[model samples]
Target chain A: MVVIAHPAIAEDSMPRATLRAILGMRLQRWPGETPVKVFVLADETPEHATFSKSVLQVFPQQLRMAWDRQVFSGQGQYPEVIASTQEMLARVASTPGAIGYVKASEVTPNVRVLKIR
Target chain B: MCVCSRFAKTTASIALAGCLLSWHTASHALDLLDGDFQLHGFASLTLVSTTDNNLFGQSDNQISKDFSEVGVNASWRLTPALQLSGGLLSRRAGGTDDGGVRLDYGLLDWAPMSSEGGRAGIRMGRIKTAYGLYNTTRDVPFTRPSIILPQSIYFERTRNLTVSADGAEVYVERFGEGGTLSASFAYGQPQTDTEAAKVPLVGLDRPGKLDSKLAPDLQILYEGAGNSYRLAFTALRLDLKYQPGYRDILQAGRFRLTPLIFSAQYNAENWSLTSEYALRRTSISDFGPYFYNGTFNGQSYYVQGTYRLTPQWEALLRYDAFYADQNDRDGKDFAAATRLPGFTRFAKDWTVGLRFDVTPQFMLRAEAHFVDGTGFLAAQDNPNPQALRRYWDNFMLQASFRF
Candidate 1:
């Protein structure tokens, strides 16, 4: 899976910790203070699990638990769950400050691929 | 009493309907202000039955629907560094808690410092107390491992005093390759005026009032390997003063409680293991000769394991134990002195349960507990001491929904 972001974002690469914070729903804004809108596939999907495990280096359950703790406690919100990689691509391509993951083969020019160092 | 019951019945029906409806539809958080403002909520209903003693109402040999939880919360990120959030809850927990709309938490959180490494923040207002792992969101059914939390440390009788407090908290967190670390310190006034809070401490309503000084609570936690392992420690202290009532037999007195807790957990791909241990020191003074005036150390712990048979189904097993006074683990001396049952002061419980996620938004669970004592029974629910039983079994079923 490749991390995809809006084409408008300035940085083409990010630290893995910063990526984790973004997907963990902790980092609420980007460098320019653009509210970061996170998107993901349903937890039960293979793409979602692979992205969470191999890409983000966290378990899908961990992400779910974290989101539950934050959402229920009024600390944060859940990432918008997309139905498919096609939808994930479209959402990331259209939404400014949006971040998501899709299969490497499915990456399109409309979205920017973020390299995790 | 009649009014309360009617209200409970009404909400129960509505919550039941809500759960049923949720199974057929997919839901998400309601977003406004360009998704910066969000609203979310959950509702749950539980049915409980016991063998030999009343619990969460008169559930002896009959099912009682006296336990339920419903809540709604909203948060707005006024700016990246500032957020305003609040939650409203209506919880029904038998004789201990009436289903009344109450503010669960309302706070303003400010984080002026942030970086790739970590961030620091301060929260002010009525904030949820960070006790053990689960205290912060114990009311949310979807977050609990069982229908009822471990009674040993998370006692329902005095939950009002430990659930939330009005004050301020400062927190710092760090994110590194090794793991994530966070710590928080809070100074707040716990609610002590409720009957639920008083009955557990004084053993009766006593017609007097209980007031508490500002309490201090601290917790530090670390999550390693992406939450594959988690460890935490917590310390809390409360000091309370009691005023005698009209023609009261007791004199003005003071009470102090200090508790230290250790928690650890390991999460695997398909299974998880968790445990917590607590030491509590309590003392009462100036209450005159009739009441107990000395200090006693209490102990409680629990170990639990959960396995996911499939993504949609899970199973649980746990052993929980509590000793009101470690020195009197069996309560023999106290029983002889007060003429109460020896087993009333301690409890050991074994539990097993199953959960089925019918959908992401709806869940169903069933659990059974074999308890060896009535240590945590609410005095208000079982007013007569003689009616208490040493050995009992409890069964519970719950349906929960969230959006």
Candidate 2:
């Protein structure tokens, strides 16, 4: 869903915080590093681009391995897979501590848009 | 042992209660279970087969077979400051004896001091030995595709002692802007006899008579940006005092052995590389002049890369080489020897493979290895003058799951 970061971040900054947290930090500490967990946004939300960029920055190898393992083991449901940025923003706004990225034009008062470095 | 059993039972009972309460609440209310009772677990299954035309020069070389194994792991947060975790592994690769459940890891971690930026804790029980950068993280089957672990750093002899020490470890971690720094100190008597017999060699030798003295081990690790590193050192000293018939052996010997290991890894978008080197030295007092006393050095290096062609498919390539002073001496057949004296040589392998990530939790990997063997040990023992080839090849496919 639509992802948002603190307003302190610049609009043109890279959307890399989520990527850094998932790849650079170990899983045990991931929850403490960010204010929100990642989720899919409703298609109506404006913050789709930021969420897409965050996903793009993640190490593909780690993501593939983690998802493949989780899906095969039948332990739990996979994270909600979304196809559009508007949907991501919609979900992020409704969900607390929910973070995702959207296009700069979609930025609104409902959620804080963070700058990616 | 009784206390440990009671502790396990009590923990299980508590977990069951938490699960029941959560189920009732979820059925009647909108809230999920108390987030404090965190439940996490993972499971994996693998199948392997090998084909050989000539079994390492044996008369009957044609052999092929397939086998599978399953592993399950669970961890529970008993409280804000305490946690309990354990794993069970079962395999049918070798025979009936090889297909039994074993406790992979079981320990209680207590964080006496913890905050958003840092934590200090002590863990006790059957803790995994933190001897290298990978040891603590090696249990997750999905972390690597290969069925066989890197042999150079984690030798075959060391597996039996993979989990050791009825002791405690104190660890501290600090989070910085770029990454984290973590360090730990551990001391205690190893729980199993396996760690003791292999003393000088780590886990190189089969169990024999055991020396029941307390052994000490220490390790530290650091991770930053795209790199992770580790340094470890362990020492053991034994006095052979029991056998009166071998009084001379007692006087001829006090043994001290130490092994040092250093490793680093860098992960990138489509490739990851890891390398490690280790050195071991042994000294004995009172052994006769003919006793071969020298440092047995072994070194191994490997680099691996992966490319994602699509969301469901990927390719991998790797090369590894290992060399050890088999003779414990510099020169060829330098003869004078003591302790487990043998020859020295090197082995190398180059591998290429592909993996299909069919789903988030399942993957199938296929790889082929071309191996070259060298050194005095590669020479044939046969009196015949015919030359023997010093190379071989093998192929393997594995499918695994982690949850």
Candidate 3:
């Protein structure tokens, strides 16, 4: 279970509206962009593996070409990776704009946990 | 030098012998207590070629015929919280004997506080600069596909020796149901060698001289992600002064605010895009001794979009532009000074490219650039004024691999 978020942004304060806005920017989605979802890896693995799997689950076929398109077009970067669950929770607790998930028990006073489904 | 070479050869031979012995020993039996404390090393060779006619204003022939570099990276994990690592580089451009080596990352990490999801650790030794969002991750082989980094943002050198300081840092992170945040702080003497006086050349040219002094610097960074968005900010401060070789130089011991960058990217199944804008204030101190200081304010920005056509192929396009205040010399703005070589001070570029991912760790990329030069070059006092305009088209291809 990773612990993450800004030191100040409390979990409850991040309403759906704020979460949407923050994630929209982090995810680089336009105002009326289509519905898209994100996920977090609970177990520890290589950072690249986590990124590849998360992205693959969302857009399986696009995974082959999406990274290159992003690099050349400068649309944005792939998702970031953390070393451990504790690191994830700490990052979420201190970062107001960050959204990551860990084990249910890891939830702290700093960040919110959003369900993928 | 002879002794050093001899020593290196002997060390290599010893290492080879040790490897053979280890192979034989392992084949005989699985001895739990037979593990020996041994030193090991690894090396890499890179070959690069460019088809662009002229790059960054150097003569077409000045391009590297076939740029090759050899380097050794070694590491020893002494304990769960302690390790030693270093690297050395030598390239054909400079003879093998002209290579340089330095401690890459050697530190004692003490994680006094630990939890399933969080830990606070202190690391000391030769620490790398964690300046911007990408600085810490820049050296990873898989980070980017190009041989040339975004020069505008990162200096290509492997080590800023002057800035690599002996110091300690504290890091804290928290991961919640939604996102994560992490923060760190460090203090140390600059690593690169500096001099009190130096001549700054333009473009990729090396400076004629350098100052010798170690200045302390401070940096702060923040990154976060929500259900749909991510945000990051990096700030740095350094103490220094700038004096052009010729002109009424502006000198001040102040922190030059290089720029504050804001970047965001959205991910979707079929498509995604990213945009970044950075604004920096140019003071007299920035235009050191190479050329005259003219218009002192400048800003640069770029936006790009990407669409995945298929699993193996993708397309991309981007527009980048930068502008500077017109040269103000002797109370006269050089905006209209066509007769003077130093009158221009603005520039812009546009680029498009494609990528083919052959595998997860390998990719081929090609990009073309169309650039316009407004004030990039100083005018030559030639009879024909039309000769002052400069422009060029550039093309690049790169095959990158990582493990």
Candidate 4:
């Protein structure tokens, strides 16, 4: 798995905690204080499960429940879920402050790969 | 009776309208706001039937459709460190609530200190109480494990008092590779003066109303092993005063309640186990000679399990118990003094339920309950405690939608 972020993000690397917070929607802004827009594959997808377990080290359903609790309680919003890795890559590359993950083989040139600090 | 059903129909129609509105808004609401803003809402309509006493209306042998819940909430990230949020909620649960729209929560959250290691913040306004694992989002159907929450701890009879309070809260969170630790402290005035709050705190026939003092609540939560294991502790103190009306048979009295709760949960891919234990200390004094004046400790707990049959389907089983007085667990002594049935002092309930997520935005659920004792039933619904049956069963169905 390769973690990629829009170029607007200040850090070229991130700690796992910060990454979890961002993916968990607890942290809304990047280091530069720019709004952080998160994108992800559908929860049921193999890519989503793989990325959540390996990169985020969390269960996909846990993330979904967290999102549901937040969204229904008006405390947070759900990350935009894409249907395919192609769409995930395309959106992460185009959208500012976007962050997502893809298979290492599918990593493209448009997005910056973030190192795990 | 006909009028109540007519009103129920009206609320159901409003819920349907809310459903359509949320669907429309979910797709476009974010685009309309600054990139930092979002809109979300949910609606649920429940049909309940009971083998005995009424619950959410005349549920005795007849399907009662009066239970409905609808809410809309919005949040805006005004800045990277500050956010503003609010919600409007309308609940129609038989005679307990009026089904009128009320401000659920309106608050400004400011994080003065934040980092990758830990963060601290304050929220000011009407804030939801951090009672247990589920109190903050208790009104939302999707967030709840069953159509109705475990009544042992989340007592609907006294719900208004703990639902939301108008005041301020401070929260701190620490993030680590091992787990996340979070704590919050809140001081606010509970929403009293409602029948739901009054009937349980005071007597159903009280001549006066209940007024609350500033309540203090504190809770700590730990999520370990990548959110698979959770533990929590909560403590809350409430003080209420009864103001008698002119020439009233009752005298002004004071009641104080302090509750401590211990909660734990274990989550796996296919199944989850959850449980919470609460000890409540209650004191009543200065009600002249006609009322019961004493202090006692109450106990409540529930053990529940949920299994995912598939991605879209789930099953739930729970056994919940409540005792009004720990010392008088059987209630015989209290019953002799008060002339109330001993069964009124305790309740044990067994529940089985199923849920189906028709889609990401909509869901359906059905639940059946076998209950013994009348401890948790609302006095307003029972009217005469002597008339309540010691054993009863209930069946309910609900459809909920959210965006």
The best candidate in terms of DockQ: 1
True contacts kept of each: 0.42, 0.03, 0.03, 0.40
Sort by lDDT, best first: what order? 1, 4, 2, 3
lDDT of each: 0.87, 0.46, 0.41, 0.86
What DockQ does every candidate get? 0.63, 0.12, 0.05, 0.57
Chain A TM-score of each candidate structure, as shown: 0.98, 0.49, 0.47, 0.95
User: What DockQ does predicted model 1 obtain?
Assistant: 0.63
Model 1 per-residue lDDT tens digits across residues B41-154: 888889999998888887889998988888888888898788899998888788887887788999998888777677789999998999888889999988888888999989
TM-score of 1: 0.95
Candidate 2, B320-383: lDDT as tens digits: 6666654433324432332222222455667788888777656787777665642212111211
Q: Model 3, range B1-403, lDDT digits (tens) per residue? A: 5447634643553454356446645664222221111222222222322232233223133442222223333343343233344433332221112223434444454545443233455656655555543454344333442333333344332124322455665666443445445466655544434221121212222333233233333343332333133445544433334322333343322223345556565656545565555554544334444334432645556666667687567777766655554234221354344344332344455667777878754666776666664332212111232444445555656554432
Between candidates 1 and 3, the one scoring higher on TM-score is 1
lDDT of 4 at A41: 89
Off by over 4 Å in 4: B1-16, B19-31
**Count of backbone collisions in candidate 4:** 0
Q: What is the Cα-based lDDT of residue B193 in candidate 3?
A: 44
| Candidate 4 docking classification | medium
Report backbone clashes per prediction. 0, 48, 91, 0
lDDT of 2 at B76: 49
Winning model by lDDT: 1
